[model samples]
Target chain A: MLNKVVIFGVGLIGGSFARSLRKAGAVREIVGVGRSATSMARAKELGIIDAIGVSGAAADGALPLADALHGADLVLLAAPVAQTEAILASIAPHLQAGTVVTDAGSTKSDVVASARRALGSKVAQFVPGHPIAGRETNGPDAAIDNLYVGKKVVLTALAENSETDVERVAAAWRACDAIIHRLTPEEHDKVFAAVSHLPHLLAYALVDDIARKPHADLLFQYAASGFRDFTRIAGSSPEMWRDISLANQPALLAELDAYMAQLTVLRAQLAANDGAGLEQVYSNAQHARHQWITAIEAAETPPSPDKAD
Target chain B: MLNKVVIFGVGLIGGSFARSLRKAGAVREIVGVGRSATSMARAKELGIIDAIGVSGAAADGALPLADALHGADLVLLAAPVAQTEAILASIAPHLQAGTVVTDAGSTKSDVVASARRALGSKVAQFVPGHPIAGRETNGPDAAIDNLYVGKKVVLTALAENSETDVERVAAAWRACDAIIHRLTPEEHDKVFAAVSHLPHLLAYALVDDIARKPHADLLFQYAASGFRDFTRIAGSSPEMWRDISLANQPALLAELDAYMAQLTVLRAQLAANDGAGLEQVYSNAQHARHQWITAIEAAETPPSPDKAD
Candidate 1:
């Protein structure tokens, strides 16, 4: 049975996985690695991991990629995208032949490419995955063990991904009670561009637009719950969004163009005082949102009123 | 000692006022008027008012606008903007000479104009007000007594407004726990156009943009808390938003133009793959949002753990 797991970049997602896995009693040990001592200390305090390691010691420990492949069963990559390629390359020589590796990166294709280039023989064992769960809050402190309980986790894998690797990755998420959705790396990027990346971009854009206005402070005050919801993602880490936008430029730009086009159409209609047209569009969107929300709620784990914690 | 209160349009705003006043024991024998039987029924169910009256009774029973409006101590016009002029015109001759006639319209100037034309002498008693609250959800069923608590209720009255009229209107809102921000009609519309109306238009535009995308379903699925928050306003009653946009057109259009310019700059930066420039904008927006939120929390009510029922 896969027991011990080493999670890189023990921040929000990584720490969350550790906590959930521990809560589910699905892991014997979790070794967390990160640069910040505070993160490492917090991870331990939160019981997110059984042990914490900083720098090289964690990198070269017994479950050191190759050694871990021998003993620790899974390696979860949650580091920043820019550092991912280097980490994959550094650990490539140490991976055990059949050891399965997975990632929780927001973007997929690049990670897949890095995996194939860094670990040739082990390419079949690497599955790229992203859990669609987060909050305006971040860090290990923000990690909620049940964050992914009913959330969708997309796994982007190539045809070459071994059945064993896919199952292992899927099993890991199932332990967290996450619903699994499978797709190709290309499909994953395109899909996320519209749903995730595009929304974040629009939010950032809207907030920026308002921020530059003279009465921005009052605007923010008058910013009802709707504005708050729309701009919440704007508060995300700039470094993360920077990488995401650049990595998925083509898809994001395409979405942006499409969004701008729709805006132009709506603007013109409003300029002409076309109430009918505006109402039709609003009704359609309202219907779509209602249906979407209903579906999501239906997919939720049966309500446990006491589960707020 | 004002015993009888007449509230026109027994919908969300009107219903909320009824509940608040009743709860505070500020008014007796409250009468509600709405064309829709369903809304009138809901108002009764919610205990919004003591009686439901047909248009004539609610509009003209309380006070005759000319000859020192007598019976109604307070009359609140809570109807749509397009209907505001006619409603005021119809009730003008009946308003008691001393009765304080106010409105809860989003756009103040137009309502003020209606007041001036409809009741030349009573114009001084006409206080145009808008409480910066209300949900995307609407109708009497959505009304709650606490809606105005901690909300900014802007009252726009001319310099000629009688002290008695202004004080009475101000006292009404204070009983409902609102912070009054007094401004002129023109200034109220201009400031709101920037802070409220423009944001709503942008949200609707974005929603329309997303709805038109090929992968709209997928895109919307990944819409995080931010997109939801931002677009929440877009789901408001079509009739209400139409009135707001049209009534506050000049200022809203100017704000829209400014936003479009900002969007164009961002689009150019994206097309050029200018990561640094993109990051700069994102960082600036993040900082602005942070500062804005901080200030809002400081100025407004504390973030409620349990939102208004």
Candidate 2:
């Protein structure tokens, strides 16, 4: 069991991770750290953390980090992507040798770079990780012990990271019932940029475009369940998404270009009134989507022991 | 009450309309028509219609139009976009002089054009209508009596349509508890193209793009609920959407261009690492979506009679 764990962002992800670990009996004392004292205190009251550490804007490393880091076995940086580097630097001096550091940031390459810059030689203990799980809700109140159950936790271990440190981080996630997969920071960034970040950006853009229309109220009135589902991600946390967009810019821009090319071809077909061409594109998408859904359902279904034999 | 109502297509929209009318006791007799005899027969068996008329491929007007059209007070052309004109033309030769004709086609301008071409002088009796309601599931089996209840039915009344004909169609939808709204065909097309059609096309394109990736299965495995909701429309009927994309090309292209412009600006912000700019866009979208949802909920909430007084 971990002696003590410090989570430097007591939001939904961090709080959920703490809850999961508590349930798994994987950690002893859990300390929640954040800029908001009220929220951190509330998190403590909600049993999301064993104690609360309010780290106010003292950038000189005088925020009683020693107490929080004393005998700490793990440090989870679950702050916004933009704040990861600062948090890393602040805690680098206090973390004991062999203490594993990890993060739940959406984008990885930037976070990995931040760990390298902030920790220097201590980066050997840093294993950048992202759990592909979240709800539209926020804060400690939204935390649940089972949020990471059956979820995917992607680890982009730095070249400097020791195998033991990486394994420790992976073990923590597995304790939370999350399956761990490793990839290069670049590969993780690219894959999520296409599947997650780009889709969120597109959703935000679509909703913004529609909201700006002259007849927006009328348009929205006619907007059915389809529009509701399509723009659901537009309701996500703006600050979090903003940090992610900037952090993974190159990969996101490349994916946007690829997507724009697809839209352009569709536009050409529509413009030419090419019914057959339109049918072909729509048919291909429909068939592919059906196949993907089928594959997902099949994977989700457990194989019977009889069938296995 | 209508003496006789003949509905072509007999799919989700058509079948739902027939079921709604039956539930409302608004029609004396409802005749279902379709290309598939089995489906039409099933629709009849399911009580979605009083009788089934299998319109065999004998486009030579040999499909006993007289019997189906005999004493018909109303006719609903609910076929696919491409088939609307043919269905309108086939029934035009037999529709009684005072018979009111309406449709549930998605694109109004195209359907209005079809009515004009098919009905000639009888176009005055045609009132193009589009009920803004549906489920992803299609066919008579998916029909629900309350599908149109509290839904908006947009009527793009043609220039040739008499006020009486328009009112007749409005009354029919009102009986099904649908609220009727009027718009010019051009305005209707533009609004829907922006809010509905463009989103559907983008969704399809995004899903198709990801499915073509070499690591598509991996990508999909990591895709969360957000991706599922965002790409839900990609699973829509290909033939139906193909027709809509082609039918509303000009408006759809315009909306697509506007959406592309928004995406391009966002891309520039990401490339420039303009966190503030990205935050502004995302914040605006999130706030707008929240407000829209609030407005929709408020609108859906029944007003107190005391407040009305």
Per-candidate chain B TM? 0.86, 0.93
- Give every collision pair in model 2: none
Determine the iRMS, in angstroms, of model 1.
2.1
What lDDT does each candidate get?
0.76, 0.86
The 10-residue segment of model 2 chain B with minimum total lDDT is B54-63
lDDT of 2 by residue, B115-194 (tens): 88999999899988999887577888988899998999999987777888899899889989999999999989998898
Q: How good is the docking of model 1, as DockQ?
A: 0.51
DockQ of the candidate models in sequence: 0.51, 0.77
Give lDDT tens digits, candidate 2, residues A150-217: 89999998888788889888999999999999888999999999889999999999988888888888
